[model samples]
Target: ERGLLCALALSREQFVTPGHALVLRLVRLSAEATAPHVEPALLAQKPLLDRHGNAPVYVAQNLLEQLAARFEFSASDDEFQAYRKCLRPRSLDENAPRPLVGRAIELLQFKAVIEATQECQDGHVVYVRGMAGIGKTRLVSEFLEM
Candidate 1:
């Protein structure tokens, strides 16, 4: 069937394996996290998507959707693309030598660092100056979501 073929193609794509695994894990984490068509039968099928020189694809939830409505932000596809383009990691393929705090990591104590230290801003770009391993960029990046 056409649907099956699409699923097959998706399963063959990169991140499908890790995503499938994450889905399995999420089955217990949150009901809303499951993909629309994620079923046990599908899980029974091949979960390990063949890695064919393709990288993982991450789809981030728009946490700022409500904020966008409150303020002025683009809800259109084009606007979303532009916002994402700005936040995407440069040279993501280049692995970091040290294991830094990945954006996906859950609630951490360093979150309070933002609260502990306060800086006045005039609603403009401000650089977070810091030393190595201080998580300055990561702090800004956490808000990026994806």
Candidate 2:
């Protein structure tokens, strides 16, 4: 609370100094640090509760909400909307990569090798090496989606 009071009392110019800057940061951090708010009804629902409990899930949700509320992307509504769109989750179909085009065969081979190796009793390393833009990354990504 004293930090907050000190931060409020300091002028913008005072904030430029290292000592004042530290005070301002500490106040900002204290302001942003909040406990998660979970409903009693939600807590009562066993299926709704994560095995680890609600704190972690609600903490993340509250943090994201706080961030979204605080975020300022200019006064333009379009800019704010654009920023909000980026925060939304895409549908699975939307997330799926475009027809992996020329890498289909390699993708299939990679998937096959991965599946075959899963039964191995010993640990093994699978390395994908290729020049840039040759779709080595694309192949791995496509394989992961499988």
Candidate 3:
């Protein structure tokens, strides 16, 4: 009952319409269990939901199967562990430095250009045009990071 109400609210907030790609992705994810009890709600809205699509019915059926699979005992412990890991989000190191090749000289040139631009009079614009694949973006990012 509570889960059904929550599901209704979630669907409304997230715009979870029938036939949307999001429904398929949500069904496949390990966090499928975390979704509210939406079966009853979906059934109630079957007429309107199914008017333009039958995908919601199929997605709901697949979700039920996945939920049932969670309760079943696994034959292989390794496989089960792998499946669990897929559900967990990967962590990233924020302290890690950005990956950039040799650009120290270019950065210095860019800094000099910026200083020169600041000293320029009114209506003067400094354009840093260069060939593609040059370290223009990298130099700009490095300058901003400082």
Candidate 4:
């Protein structure tokens, strides 16, 4: 909660530093400052990926390496995908749509008009249609309520 408050305190206009990488290389010559023998040996080892094309492994590795060096996280592809999914937002809740049948009936009105004109009956099977929010659905609801 405190962290959230602190984050909320930050202004959207604030400028933030992205990331900075620092590489360190140490050389030792036979338990001491090594000449340059290690450089050739290290270069001789073939890279994990061939030079044909950027493989998924290399791409994922590069992404993970960048994320690790920047965010201090070295996650696998599945983990990264899961984390990315977390960043995505689900659409608005559809379980309960707005303007419920009763509420829509209230809005559509005309139910009173229908009741006044036609006698109410069970299974009336009233069908209302309109362009956009013209209240056809609401009309049906109002009639149903009556």
Looking at model 3, report the run of 10 residues with the lowest lDDT sum.
80-89
| Per-residue lDDT over 1-146 for candidate 2, one digit per residue giving the tens place of the 0 to 100 score | 23323333442234333221111111134667875423322322324222331121111222334334322212222312211211212234655445665777787787677777777755557798988877787778778888
- How does residue 136 of candidate 3 score in lDDT? 74
Give the per-residue lDDT of model 4 (tens digit) for 79-138.
Answer: 233121011112446554333333544444556555645775533433456699766665
RMSD (CA, angstroms), candidate 1: 14.4
Candidate 3, residues 30-133, lDDT tens digits: the string is 75457565544444344442334222211233233443322222232241221211121124465556455577776777677767777884344446678997
Clashing pairs in 3: none
Q: Candidate 3 overall Cα lDDT vs. reference?
A: 0.43
Listing every candidate in turn, what is its Cα RMSD in Å to the true structure after a full C-alpha superposition? 14.4, 20.2, 16.3, 22.1
Name the TM-score of candidate 2: 0.31
Candidate 1 local lDDT, 57-139, one digit each (tens): 22223433322222232233342232211112234344444343454343254344444454542234445667997677666
Measured with C-alpha atoms, the lDDT of residue 135 in candidate 4 is 60
Whose lDDT is greatest here? 3
Pairs in steric clash, model 4: 28-34, 29-32, 29-33, 29-34
Measured against the true structure, the TM-scores of the candidates, in listed sequence, are 0.19, 0.31, 0.26, 0.20
Task: Give the residue spans of candidate 4 off by over 4 A.
Answer: 1-90, 100-109, 118-127, 132-135, 142-146
**Ranking according to TM-score, highest score first:** 2, 3, 4, 1
